[model samples]
Target: MYKSLRTFSFLFGYLPVAAMNLKKFQAQKANLSKQEYDALIHTEPQKWAKGIMARTKSRVETSGLDYLPDGPALLVANHEGNFDIPVLLSEIPKPFGFISKKEVKKLPVIPVYMEDMNCVFLDRTDRKSAYKSIADTVGKLKDGHSILIFPEGTRSKGEGVTDFKSGFIRIAKDAGVPIVPIAIHGTSEIMEKNSNQIRPGHVTIRVLEPFSAEEIEKLDAKELIEKVKTTIETEVQSMAQRKADLQ
Candidate 1:
């Protein structure tokens, strides 16, 4: 309880630092190459995320990070909680962005921030807009950027992963990029399971094998998504078992 409150206060404490860094990134966005831009922009946020987790006396343990490809690839992960974003920023070796709802576009600085960070926005209610979103994502990927998507479309909040939406298949197929499956566990315990409170918890991030673009090109949509889902599910179950064993 006190930990959560103090953590929130620490977050607020960092707002000025975040603002200063965002301003710097915004200014540098045009001059840097994609790789340089990703590496530069993600540094501060990653540090901030780790700081927040540390303040709560929480930790993250990750494995199979070598599974991440050096080239562009679509990162697919199970949505467990809000902390998933912070966890990824803190743990993943490389920088990546995710699709956001257009509703966030209305916010003041966010849209620009997201744009500088290589994120895209779409209106879920509009079919045409969704298609455009996919096309835009494909274009970015082809331009040499990696993207992370939560195919479940909603957080399971540690209740076990739900069914994945099929849109990811189209993104990978059209972009000609590989699909990297990431299985994450225990983030929900830090917030969602604690009644929105922060608590000390260990989160696990397992970066499973990637399905190469050649594999993406060969498999049908249904088969591909099924295979990806099964891979993530199997890893998540194994992560759960490990946590239980240490109890």
Candidate 2:
């Protein structure tokens, strides 16, 4: 009961302040390029996220970043917790964007920040709008902004990952950007699906090697998708298993 109340209060109290921040964000977004916007977001995100992580008592250990491409690449990961998105934004060093659900655009301040980061929003229920989102996302990628996409589209609690959605592959192909497979584990332990409580926990994010766009083009799209999906799942499961073993 206390946890639920805490979550509700947080939402209600933060909304109005967040709205004001959104207006400030909109006034600034027009003057920035995708990279510039990313820089702007990160300027204070680290300090802010550090404080939040401290409050939530969340710990994140990242591996394989050394293997990631230094250039623009599509970043794909499994969404697990409500906190995972912010965790990624606060942790990942690259100037990246996210392909988010349209509902997120309705948020008070977050959508403005997302837009500043060159994030694209898709309405899954509207097929046409979704396609337009894909097109716009590809354009952003082409303009030199790497994007983070949750191929599973929604949080899947702490269970195993769901099937990869193919729409992201089309955007990657269209943009001719490399794909970076990221496997995140233990996020749901911090904030589970359908719940807002921030439980104390640790998470792992593993950055896999870049799979080149040119490499994907030679093979059938279906085959390429399968390969990437298998690789990411395998990595995520391995990390999860390792974490369990340690515990």
Candidate 3:
């Protein structure tokens, strides 16, 4: 309870203050050099994410980072919980954005920062909006920015990983980028499993081998989806078993 309260205070207090600074930073975007702007836009999220993880006393460990492609690639990850994003941001040594639900766009000043980071807002209920979001994500990928997507469309909030939707496959094919599969386990224990109360948890992330554009183009939509899903699912199960064995 104490940890949860402290984490909430950080979110509620620190974010608002950061927003004021974000506005001033954006206003000066035209004058600042690209390096200066990029550093802040990317590092700030990592800082906030690490802060959140620290406040909760969570431990995150990642492996297989060498599997990452040399250039921009679609980061496909299964959504495990609310802390999943923070865990990735803090652990993955990459500068990228993610596909966020439209509801997050309503949050105060957070959306402004999300936009700066090239995050896409997805409206799942609105077909047209969802399609537009896909296009936008592809555009960003083509522009040399990596983008992460939770293909499950919603959090499993448990040990199970739901089937991935096929829409993200289109984005990967259209952008002609490699598909990097990521398997994340144990994040939900931080919040979702505790009924939204923050708690210390161990999160393990594994980056599976990436499929090149040539390989992705060879498979049918269904085949690609299942392949990526199976790869991630297998890793998730492996991580789960290892944790259980330790316990």
Which one wins on lDDT? 3
Per-residue alpha-carbon lDDT of candidate 2 for residues 51-146, written as tens digits (9 for 90 to 100):
455556678888888867866788988877777776776677776778777788676666766776778988889989988988998998888878
Candidate no. 3 TM-score: 0.93
List lDDT for all candidates, in order. Answer: 0.88, 0.77, 0.89
Ranking by TM-score: 3, 1, 2
Total backbone collisions for each predicted model: 0, 0, 0
Whichever of 2 and 3 has more TM-score, that candidate is 3
* Model 2 pairs in collision: none
- Residues 25-74, candidate 1: write the lDDT tens digits: 86887998889988887787788778878887877899999899998889
Best by TM-score: 3
Candidate 1 vs. true structure, TM-score: 0.92
Name model 2 segments beyond 4 Å from true: 1-37, 193-196
